[model samples]
Target: MSESIGPVLRVIGCAEADLPAGPARQVAELEAAVWPGSSPGHDPALTPRTMLLVDGAGTVAAALSLLYKPVPLAGRTYRAAGLSSVVARPELRGRGLGGRLVAAARAELAADPAVDLALFSCDRPLAAFYEAAGFEVLPGTVLVGGTPEEPLATDHPGFDKVVLAAFFTDGPGRDRAAFTGVRVPLHPGDTDRLW
Candidate 1:
């Protein structure tokens, strides 16, 4: 459960496994509509959680996934969480529901003592949306996903992506600058190729 963010909209969350049947189905349908055959949004190995934004009628308005895992950046490993698979119902796209969900998730991560930072990548065009939700674009930083053996990077040809992040705690040796302009070896593995 979450505090009401609007008169008619509230944010609720659960571990991916704990999501109730109704919202689960809505989330599945929404994912299929947006990403025809993409992998599941929550990677169990990453301790994933799902956040749903719902109207007062108890209908899903928007949804997103959060994955917590150790992320390596600039030679140090930090506890991190990444936002993934964000989608607002087609009819509700222009009303800022997705932005609300993302901001709520950012707040949740910031409040967690275990999370050192939040990191994720979005298409170049959507960078501003994520920025409006309180994430700072890390210019020229590449997020490398997949395993080191078969990595995928934001900087790869034909992929216009930008890394966005919010540091909740000081990183190794209390150095935040270590993350700037460097490649983050996120490597959430094959299932989430670029989470």
Candidate 2:
């Protein structure tokens, strides 16, 4: 189902076919507009996932990608949803669109029995925003590109040392913890910190 928060904001599920041909390019443009040089992955269409679009007055204002199923780690299996490519138009900040998009994404994930947790990376400043939305700061170090030296930075508050956060569908540790204290490699020089 879809939801409309107001005249300027409409939330709806979009299919892979609905995503434009150059989604990576489009996502790059959105990331650049908001965070300058961070390279976000653009492969939602290649995965078993759902895309949520937040449009403002018929224009694409924001987008979120949610991936379902287990993420295979070194020796463990974890059931979680991967959230990525969350973006909002540069001119539309502070209007509650981001939060609304997150809420909608969370709601969608919660309804799925296969998903036990939600995982994503965000720069420091927006950590509180996600925290307020029901995500808790997982204890551990986040290494960017498998190197702890390349720290992720952002203007969102309380996230200066955090590069990512994991939100549990049933609280922390009740279900398996995906990638606990694990390092996920990011692309080199891709510092667009918008998450």
Question: Best by TM-score, which number?
Answer: 1
lDDT tens per residue, model 1, 6-104:
989999999999988889988999999899986555668988899999988779999999998887655667898999999999988999899999999
Error of 2 at 85 (Å): 1.8
Off by over 4 Å in 2: 20-28, 35-41, 44-56, 72-76, 141-172, 176-195
lDDT per residue, candidate 2, 132-184, as tens digits? 76666554635343123654433224645554445455555543254456554
Candidate 1 TM-score over all chains jointly: 0.94
Query: For model 1, which pairs clash?
Result: none
Per-model C-alpha RMSD: 1.7, 5.7
- Each prediction's TM-score versus the true structure: 0.94, 0.65
Clashes of each: 0, 8
Superposed model 1: Cα runs more than 4 Å off: 170-175
